[model samples]
Target: MATVAGVAVEGGHWIGGERVSSPTTFDDVSPIDEKVIAEISRGGEREARAAVEAAGKAFPSWSRTSREERARLLHAIADGVEKRLDQLAIVETTDNGALLRSHLRGVMPRVAHNFRFFADWLLTLGHEDFETRGHRNHVSWDPAGVCALITPWNAPLMLATWKIAPALAAGNTVVLKPAEWTPLTASLLADITAQAGLPDGVFNVVQGYGAEAGAALVADPGVRRVSFTGSVPTARHISTAAAANLTPLSLELGGKSPLLVFADSDLDLAVDLAVEQYDNAGQVCLSAVRLLVEESVAEEFTARFVAKASALNQGDPRDLATDIGPQIHRRQFERIDGFVQRARAEGATALIGGGPNTDLGGLYYRPTLFTGVAAGSEIVNEEVFGPVLTLQTFRTEEQAVEMANSTRFGLAATLATGSEERAARVSERLVAGTVWVNCFFVRDLKAPFGGSRQSGVGREGGDWSFDFYCDLKNTVTAPWEK
Candidate 1:
């Protein structure tokens, strides 16, 4: 068997259920060792057009597929992913350096679950019919033609499935563009879907840089809907390109999500929840990057939070014991470190680590903590996208909510309080798309997930996702009296 690091994995574009070559190719380098592990086909506008055209060709028949047929195919995909979970986990760990244990336990399972969730949920869809004087109205859903799915590198396979499964389940053909930084598992997924018997041209992938393939995929007139999960800047660009053709979009963008800890709450639990920022090395868009503590317990909470954060084990992702791993790439590592240094220069005191851990090797950064982060400072406002947390204190519940709502990102937030009334009140006051009280990162497939404001545009789970991928249509019949 070929090991993840040693295998010379080579992938080309999967167009119309067949592998196609590109004139140029790029190397998939492992972030853990900064070594080339695979060679990937470099697609551009030409490839994007081919993929979109192929999806468009497939759309008519695919959209006509029965709900039961789609559901069965989705279930088959889930089973395929389950069978290959261990292999995919290792490939992802090698590709992006997310901890192997976390990838296997947390991320890869979700890849299968996403497909299963959508497959099962499709059966429960509810439609309504209306009766009027001499007329009857029936409502139905129709696939919105070809869709473009662009996913980021942080949790590539899981996030990709989050979009792909629902799109397919809703009967939309897709042209997926995985992030340039991580394409191995995505390539693997195309093969899995093929093995699962997804029809030709129904699902396609074009692997290349965002500037080349990503831009073309979104801008293509053939793509009727676009779903993207990445940075705010990239979303802005995609938003512009997509707007020209009036393509509908589902954007799951960045977050500077906040965690509020109250004096009446358990400080130890709060600390443990806040430490989740270091998960995936804080590359997650919904990671609680900001901490807002009640003034009554601010000092004590900060002390415990810093202590626990300082103790997290950071090293090789292959090690099951390693709690954290390297940042995705050298540029990301340096960008995060630059943010920390700039924050320090702006008078924010680093309560713990503030620089890269060269001793740990290969683009690793020490999990940094900061206090005295001024409101509207670069560090507090902008996403560091690393294992860094900034602390702020508020005296009143109103103040905590205000601070949490201050960022352009309204992705998600968490609060801890003893009073149920307070939890209810704070949860309502917060401007985030999802608010967690006394817990962190708790998610239900039934709950719609997305952000408000600049964080994102549309929801992506449950019926919301089903709706996003299809256009709701209504038909009316009138008696011959007219």
Candidate 2:
């Protein structure tokens, strides 16, 4: 274990309810100041295999547990998470460089909610049963056994629990391989779950890079199902590895989502949503980074949007006043800088924040807004995963929809319009899986949440989550009055 800035890091894998260490370790660097925060256990194929085997051994007993028992345990887990809310929030902010205010207010709460929601949802879950021609048919959802969950760095606990809660509630053992950059919180979560009285091997965490532990976890034949939230290219690699065993996968990949602002929209509200692209420094997959405004109000919207974005405070995430924080690491910082530089070279005009916030130093990037962006250009179509926004104009509703659906990615979209009819009509046509009308990033745990097209493969929320974590079976009976 190592300590930095009063935060202690447990640099080991949590396997079968115990801490397992590796001979080799890797430095866990904080993007806040580019300092080595901890040295984490460097898990490889062997560790991944051990974790999976532990989960496999626990599956039969866990899968056989009553739904009531599972629900009770999940509630306990949620309670445990709530108890450590402040500590978890601060640790996550330190690890990932996301604003502590945001984590404390929303992200940490949502994490606990993920467990509670799934726990209660599991209790109320009802399967389909029908009778036709005096014959009975029943549909049952059974735990699928060992589940492999690979989560990303951004919003680590929230996103990881989005998959873990449902997987556990559905009575499947989970082997989680959190992103190496932000592995601390996941390690902490393992301890929390254990304290919550979860059975050994029911939930496990392996800390390492994606290619090593992540690849091994996905490629393991013992893994009955896989849920991954990350980039599209990595999804493809996981797809290839899982294809070998014909294992089912639920992928929540990258997005170049669009936000369409109509002329009738409230100018102030529209600006607020547009500026939200910089939330968590724009690492959000569901963020509408591509701003498509009606030509009638393009000038007004762009002016207000740029103003709000430019005013965003980029500083230490622990500060309550900060709106934006550093990129996860130097590599991500360089990646964002590259995108801005290329956009500049390609003739796009930056209305605000063209480069790094050198005043703040470290990995902090300015909230950037680019106009005069060419259609189908690299900046317009690619997922920058940074605090960068690109603006474009559309002449009519048709053009707006066309521009919104133009990209290969379609994870989510935001539409702002005063007309209720137009909101309904436009939302129906958006290619993304989830469309927010007159709002941004407002989510309901019961709603089906995932992506479409290149953005992702399947949905997960409410019963949709169980569909991935469990195997469905149909039981039919012949007429009793034959």
Q: Which candidate is the best by lDDT?
A: 2
Name the lDDT value of residue 467 in candidate 2: 87
For model 1 the TM-score comes to 0.97
- In model 1, residue pairs whose N, Cα or C atoms come closer than 3 Å (at least 3 residues apart or on different chains), thus clashing, are none
**What is the per-residue lDDT of model 2 for residues 35-154, given as tens digits with 9 covering 90 to 100?**
988999999999999999999999999999999999999989889989988888999999999999999999999999999999999988877689978779998889999999999999
Angstrom error at residue 349, model 2: 0.9
Residues 246-358 of candidate 1 have per-residue lDDT tens digits of: 99999988899999998999888898888877899989899888989898898888878778887889899999999989999989988998999899898999888898886
Query: Ten consecutive residues with minimal summed lDDT in candidate 2?
Result: 1-10
Estimate every model's Cα lDDT from 0 to 1.
Answer: 0.90, 0.92
Task: Give the C-alpha lDDT of model 1.
Answer: 0.90
- Listed per model in order, the count of residue pairs whose N, CA or C atoms clash below 3 Å is 0, 0
